[model samples]
Target: MAVSRLDVFYRRLLLTKLFIGGWGKPEDLKRIFEFRKIIGDRERCKSLVPKDYPVYINKTEDLTDCQIHDGFFMSPLEHLVPGILPPEAVKARFQFIVPKKWQRNRPVCIHLAGTGDHFFWRRRTLMARPMIKEAGMASLLLENPYYGYRKPKDQRRSSLKNVSDLFVMGGALILESTVLLRWLERDGYWPLGMTGISMGGYMASLAVTNWPKPIPLIPCLSWSTASSVFTTGVLSKAVNWTELEKQYAINSVYEEEIIKLLEYCGADSFKMMPNLLKNVNSLEHLLGLSGDHEVSVSQYSKTQMEAEVDGGLQGYRAGEREQQLSSVNSKGTSLDTVTR
Candidate 1:
């Protein structure tokens, strides 16, 4: 009997998943550590920013215009501070819809948008707005970095520069959410919770993970293993793995050299590379490891997902590892480097 292409692919995927430990036990701390290191530094990534710290409302009356919306210009903390050029700068638009039964002092739910192709408008309308309104809560729709309004017009669509730029934008968005939450607290509006879909879900995970304080986070279609996305069969087409593998290999060879430059700087383990590189060729085989859906239905339960998000947040707060995941500045300084 002849083997079909689908059969070959499934076999390869199973092996790759086993090698990468994608479907392994959750309590495997070693796998968790390896996974985190592969993603570089989540904190150093870019995200959204508010135009103003206070986010002043022009008129109290305008709040009554349930359908009114506006954009505000704000830079993430890294961008605002001099001597730091972390991957990208984030400028986000604030979108809101006032519900008919709006209470003046009700808590607000902020929805962070997801990645690829577009921004958070559809998510805001379909998910965030409806949920917020149903709960009698106000809502704010935050655009992800390198998405919707934040994407540069001159850049080619889905290019490496565009993708890299979005990573930076993601970091900025995290910081922006933190600042916005603080601002809202000052204004007497409690941040009830946050939710995201797809890429937005990724950002929400990072936000809760990196946030200094505990915030209620609900990330739909979330995955704890980012390496799985790059190394798995499903997202192989999404990112140019062939090119990325080359980059990862180059970075691996220079890891020691790079570390020597920042002796005092914090760094994560370097074990994630070998698996990532080894599995690069087997990505197509791993498709059957998980389903076609973005969400990991078989591997992670709802409780498990929530716990992982919480664990990521705790990791950030504890500062168990260094913040600099990659070189963000052209000067060869790591993103986490603090210069006086």
Candidate 2:
């Protein structure tokens, strides 16, 4: 298939609007260089997260149809990296939307943030509300570290300061997601799953691998390898290649030490698929996760399919709305540095 002229035009327009804030303070990369070993090694990364952590529920709002619960928890990244992160980014924030009356079979999905998604509104309004309305599904929306209330004060609008910020965001999300998953299980929200769009999808893929049990992993509009998106895609225009090149040329540390450490990170989705599938032990697990629901997996799938179809139709109609929201600014610094 050939690329559409409209798509090309969209990309070009996006390039011009996004990432006006170039590569931020070069000093920020120092922490990443120091901790490159931990970032690269899966086992070392896992060691940082505490198995049993508490999520403090700050407040709850009762809606006409559903109830919204807001909460916060200390991100494990603080323990690993110490004072590297801004104070705001250290405390992770989230919103959970649940049905007033629980369905016999409770279905909940954690929706991750896409590129330029700052707060909970995009996922809540576009995805969560519909899923809850149609299928009695609940949604847990996580605030990505480098976004929303957690975003660093000094960072430019949505554009992260340094290359290391991306690594930090990834690490923080992986551990923070597990905390939410365990909390859901404890609260008896069964048939849980994870899903995200674009950048969120890639982050979801990385988070799911660290999970011990099986769950439905749905990553929308994402690919196995991310290198091309940064190197060849229109998004590439957002990168501050001139500044990075200047630093790379002047500082032998980036060339000799930092470049070598980065060789350990890879984001190929295919590599994560097996780990995602390895723990599927039965039919119900196939439907979602292990659950004691009276409803059958086939029946749940039927409901989900219907919800998805309806959601897809709505998404298509709201395509322009979504594009405007995503084009707000380029907060995803990780996508830019992936090319290097």
Candidate 3:
């Protein structure tokens, strides 16, 4: 089906202005790279979020269909980043909307802010209010760092000053989401889930991945990764690519060191063939292939695999490392299989 003209127009309109400034300070990204090892591992990432933190509820308003509860907690990033963060961005604010009448399931979904979504107004009026009235579902609208009440005074609109700012926002949200999820669980909220639009959606996905329990995740207008958005999506127009390219060409550290680190850490997707092959058997199950039609990477297509490894044996050997870690299967998959 073809996309409607109105859809095209609105998407363009929404993505018009973003990343106004050039990649602010190349060194800023190095800060993000430092946390890569921890963030890449679920257990390590969860360790960053404190198990105990006080959430101070400041205000409450009784609505016809729901009650709006406002509260905030000190951002965990404050201690992590120390002097790097602006004062205003330290406090994580949120709006919790609970239905007047509780449903039997008592489901509450966390809503994360998307690009240009500065405050709770858009999510509250559009999602939270409607959800509660219709299904008696509750909502917790999280104010992303460098957005809304947490936005730095020096930052202009929602355009983050640095690339690291985006990473920091995601990290903060992941930690904060865990805190909220735990709080909700303690308060007797069952069947918790998370949802967000665009960038918010991506953040929600990341947050959900770190969660130990099974929960519903709705990532609207997002993909498994943000690379496609920056490279080819409508949002690409908003980036200062000329500046990025110019800096990449001139900066030896960014061009050389970053590339080396990414590949060394197995973060480079192109160099992930070994990891891909390790899970190749799972593909058979995914494809619903029977025992009679069993297929291995080599047996499936020798030509395609050979073509991918241009330099023959040396190319295949390069990916093999003694310290490489194997991927763990998700509990959900095992549970589903057992039920079946």
Summarize candidate 2's per-residue lDDT along 1-340 as a digit string, tens digits: 3656765785765533332343334455556555655544556655656666788889999998899999999987787778767788999999999988776689899988987899998899999889888889999999998799988887666766665677677777877898899888888889989999988888888788777778899999876545445544645566666666566566666545544544435664434434433333455655564444625555555566456655765665474354334321222123323221
Report lDDT (CA) for all predictions.
Answer: 0.48, 0.70, 0.70
Q: Which stretch of 10 consecutive residues in model 1 shows the poorest summed lDDT?
A: 15-24
Better of 2 and 3 by TM-score: 3
Give lDDT tens digits, candidate 1, residues 255-320.
Answer: 434334334325333333334444533553565454444245433434464466566666764442
In model 2, which runs have C-alpha deviations exceeding 4 angstroms? Answer: 1-7, 11-47, 264-340
- Output the lDDT of residue 211, model 3: 88
Candidate 3, which segments miss by more than 4 Å at Cα?
1-21, 264-340
Worst ten in a row by lDDT for model 2: 331-340
Residue 215, model 3: Cα distance from true site in angstroms: 1.1
All candidates in order of TM-score, best leading? 3, 2, 1
TM-score of 1: 0.54
Give per-residue lDDT, candidate 3, residue 132.
Answer: 81
Which scores greater on TM-score, model 1 or model 2? 2
Clashes of each: 19, 1, 0
